[model samples]
Target: MTLYLCLPLLAVLLQPALCLNCSSQFERTPDNSDLIVDCGTSVITLQINLCTAHWAGFNSSDLALNGNHNNSKCKGSIDTSVDPPVIHYQLPVNDSQDNPCRQSLQIVDEAPDPSGPFSAFSSIQSVIITGYIDTPRSDQGVISYSTDLYYHFSCRYPLEYLINNTEIVASSVSVATSENNGTFIDTLMMRVFNGSDYGYGLSVPPTGLELRTRIYVEVKAVNLTGNFNVLLDHCFGTPSPYNMSQSEQHNFFTGCSTDQRTTVTSNGLSKVARFDFEAFRFVQHRDQAKSSIYLHCILRLCEPTKCQELLSACNSRRKRSLTPFGEESNESATVSVGPLYTAREDTPSAAAYSNNMAPESAEDDVTGLVVGVVFGTAAAVALVLGGWFALKKYYRV
Candidate 1:
């Protein structure tokens, strides 16, 4: 009976350490810990960095007029009825790490094991105040000198699940040569068109087509020190201006190849993965007559551990598997995307053409003389007629 009574007391003590609203792997301190509010002339910058665990997912929608309805995700009110109108705003734990305004938190390592020489886990479970900051006022102050400020404490967990760890880079991209194999050859063939031009005495048929280039996208994945698969969700080469309808921007691709996406698997323990993207067609931009291919790709990084857990949970529910890509597979996906790099061809400058002018031929000289003589005679006649008309008009007047 004494042990049972103590158990209730122990549970009550630990309850305060629990995260607010959302479930997390670590114990969470109150959001008020290490909180500092700096109210500037135009903006309110709230800094909260001292929590053992933190929740950084508060969104802009929570500040709506009726946004705190029922005091669910967030709570607060504005008292316009009072002098200077006290605005009571409470932060909520409704946002996720993938939120655009959310800041990135780095994982901290705990103390080393006393009994063993090795350290603890790769990362520690802690509350980090690395996430979005609420800028209440962008152009003017929301809190007046007499306005009262009453905010609440809010936090949540599973810090590693945030979108802060993924990174993608495009190391190199070039026109795919013949050695890349048959598919490239086929793609090149489709883009090439047979045309005729006789620059000299010789008549030769030339293959004229926009160059079909391939992009190499590298992703700096996280926790993927093991076997995993990388999926290229979408890739499109966008011109600098989206509204550009030039031939190079629009006519390169046979169709929207990005719509038919594919996946690739990295077989061993690798932290860096490479993806070859060839869905986009390359055409010369009008600016310099050099083709600029701005490639953007959305990549999904998947591993086995999280994939299995999500799969099991979805299966137990007897519902259709809600995979990362909404497929039946157990791939916990994190998105990394970018306009990796632009591929452009070299073109000669206008100065080069001007400097390489050819000497004038006798035929050209004769054409120039005839044109000048005709213009000179017409100008002289027009001047004489103008003088006669002026004199006639003056006499009549």
Candidate 2:
């Protein structure tokens, strides 16, 4: 019995020594005074407590087991927790006035961190712009403003006028978006046309007026992971004036004519012209952004006739007339009848002639006396009148 028991113990210790076809090797290590076995392979190494259980057969089925074992294989996998890109934008802090002539305006933007500041989880792929032009009450005529995100990075758009009350001078768009160095820029322009032209037989000059331009900027950030975010900013241009040229001035004034009753004709009427009154410029400082200029335009109207009339009236009052029919007479004279004349008889020189002959002779003497007195008086008055009487007599003759 003693020999058999010793044989079994020896066999137990020698089992690990058997020559297996497997090329892998098993090594033993001591941990806390306990010996552990490490099985090594090309793909993985597994640790086991030699005292717990003996090695079983290396069946292919064991490789399929999902549980932990002394000898296990390792597989590779990919990490998908990558961080996204970032985006940012800068613009003028102040609002801008309206512009009628400019079809486009530039809007500046700044980005310190192309990977963050605005969006940390994505890259900025494009920017969208939208808004309307404000028609200020101070504006002399209607103005039309338009915007295009594709052509202009700034909110600058064209401006125009409306034919009817329902016509819109403002417009919006989502046309195109641009990506530049992880930063986005946009532009817009405005237009203003003449609405009314009054006729005064002279050319009308362009009328200047004040208007407001409003714009909103939105950014789209798309990341490598296909994620995105949108940020918005409200900016404005300064109030600008619509300018007019000499030719435009002519078209404005003579383009329309008024009837005797002061009725105006509309067929030859033309649109109004506008000009920018304020200057617009972008201001940049170290990392911050701000608007340095205001959007605005001056207003003017065609009024050559009015100016000429004013000048003529002023000159007419300055110099006095030298002719006899002077300004005073021309202003005060009236058409009427001339002075009247009456006939008179002298005292009957009666008694001298007694009967018919005496009466007749008396009548003749009386007439002659009256005529002499009248002639004498006339001669005295004529002498006093002098040249004036002579001229009057010549004209009468």
Candidate 3:
């Protein structure tokens, strides 16, 4: 009976041994024993090993039996997995409506490149002029001019308002002409209170004009009261309604040709001289008073040889005198040189040089600032989180 009671006592003591590997007691799994541990919502079964040394006269078999019977119970702890901080890559901010004037009217040959070397000359084949007209029932206006090597000119006419034969000027005239002689010319006139359905008529002399050289012509009509402006641009004939008509054709002025001659009385006898002369001299001279109309046309249609001679003469004159310093200065001087000189500076602005560039768009700058702030904040947060994790690991070690 005593041995039977001892067996029950031993069983009760063995229960504690089994509890040694309990999962709830410790975070790590027991080795070499029938034990189970919990690791963040995961169950880990472990085989725990036990070694015993019996003292003198102690029962080794009993100890072995106790060791074999040891067991454990464990319950896993709940785990909440953290989601990766969503790094919303602030998309590179950009403007939805960037109305950039990609095309520039300034002569590109003179513009400096933002990078290293100067940029190549980009030909401006055409130009589109746009404006808004409010008084005339709100209309958007656009005018385009094709590129012509011979004649290239641009002009603007301001709206003129007249009340009882009085001239009202709202905006000053805006005029730009090329200083490259024989390239462009402009003539301006305004008529007020012309008793007709049309409020005014702006007439330019040599109106139905034709040229023997490459030329560019432009005219502008402005109504001051209405605050509206109209422009007329003509390039000496690549193709158009402004092309040379049969009646418009005139004799090629060979006065400037070295091979041509006219009667000259040298020794009391009429002699034909072969001195070089401009062929279109008569036309140029006759139209001298009307250079605003004829210079471009003459240069555009002038024969190549004639054109070369004119260009050479211009270059020689340009080199000879330093009177014209800049584009506007040269234009003013050329126009003052009578009709022929004025026509040569037709594309005056083409020679303009300025140290200042056009202003930047406000929208682009604001967008860049906004994007910088957003990304900067996100990076700061990420850096703080990383530093915290590193510090925790260091302290634990």
Candidate 4:
């Protein structure tokens, strides 16, 4: 039985023009031939009947795809009891940083046109697997009719479609604004902690603070793919959910921080960025009640090269930047977290309700989100200039 994959994949099966010396006499037996590629979390379970022409009898020793030398590596079993008998090759191929089988990755980036299979995506990532089937020949003639059957196949699994697959998991609260570019989400998780090492997270965020209590904020960008990192372009705090340009606003990055104590301790170093500033309460309006402020940040995704360039250009981040962020490039996405309470109440009444920074409330704005995926890593992310090569699948002739 062929193992079918639950996740949808765009698979391309290609074959050579000649089926070795047997091409003249035999044809592929579709009914008896089975090619199953089971892409598991870590391994790709491949089950393909040995490549042989119709009614051809082949021995295990004569077969060589990955190799016939070691059964522990590339093994096979014969189903001779069946009507015509078939050689089943079941190989567990590993696709990881240590790519032993030499599988490759190719990123296809182009404008969406109304014509082809690629029309749906402006950017797509494809994993390609290639191999050849070898069968020995007897009498070598004048033309040397010896040849092996070569084959190669690829699957298109866009990062967007990666949602249901176990390959990538999102472990944070995220808000995404996109259409056909589903799952190309950008997540920026933030929290206000205390101390120099970003130590001790607040039991309740934006918890009540005294007038001179300097605040420590940490923002992390996660789940980005390819050759890119994230950068904090502009960050500021507003007294209310809305960006009130005039009054109760404090700049953390724009090369301007009212509090000179403010500093971007880390940036472009890793995934997390840290900064601190003396906490201050908004001027209580004559009709106002309690004091609250919100944090807003604009994040940009860039390749390591550009990220380094932007890191130097981000004049205000003297405070902090990626402590980590990546490459191609994309526009920016703005995300925020807060409603931090700065009002000092000895016996605070509303402090208990400040825990709304949960995932459920992450919908309204970036107010409650603490974790999520990174933007620009998906959608028409328009990036990653990998080596372009014309991979030729050849059968030894």
lDDT of 3 by residue, 1-397 (tens): 9999999999996663443322332332222222211111011111111111111111112221112212111111111121211101010011113312111122111222222111121211111122110011112346433211110122121111111100111111223343322122232222211112333432222332233332211222222111112211111111111122312322212112212231111110111001111213234335343233222111111223433443465346532111101122221211211122212223235343221222244566778999999999999999999999999999999
The regions of model 3 sitting more than 4 angstroms off are: 1-357, 360-363
* Model 2 weakest lDDT span, ten residues long: 158-167
Please give each candidate's TM-score: 0.25, 0.13, 0.16, 0.41
Write candidate 2's Cα lDDT for 359-395 as tens digits.
6778899999999999999998888889788889999
The runs of at least 3 residues in candidate 2 whose Cα sits more than 4 Å from the true structure, single-residue gaps closed, are 1-216, 224-228, 231-397
lDDT of 1 by residue, 307-369 (tens): 344345434763321111122111111222222223344455865655565345556888999
Task: Please tell me which predicted candidate would have the highest TM-score against the true structure.
Answer: 4
- Each prediction's Cα RMSD? 26.2, 37.8, 50.1, 32.4
- lDDT over C-alpha atoms for residue 374 of model 3: 97
Q: Tell me the RMSD of model 3 versus the true structure.
A: 50.1
Error of 4 at 262 (Å): 2.0
Strongest candidate by lDDT: 4
- Report the Cα lDDT for residue 180, model 1: 11
lDDT per model, in order?
0.32, 0.24, 0.24, 0.45
Q: Which segments of model 1 are wrong by more than 4 Å?
A: 1-210, 222-231, 241-272, 277-287, 305-397
Q: Give lDDT: candidate 4, residue 383.
A: 40
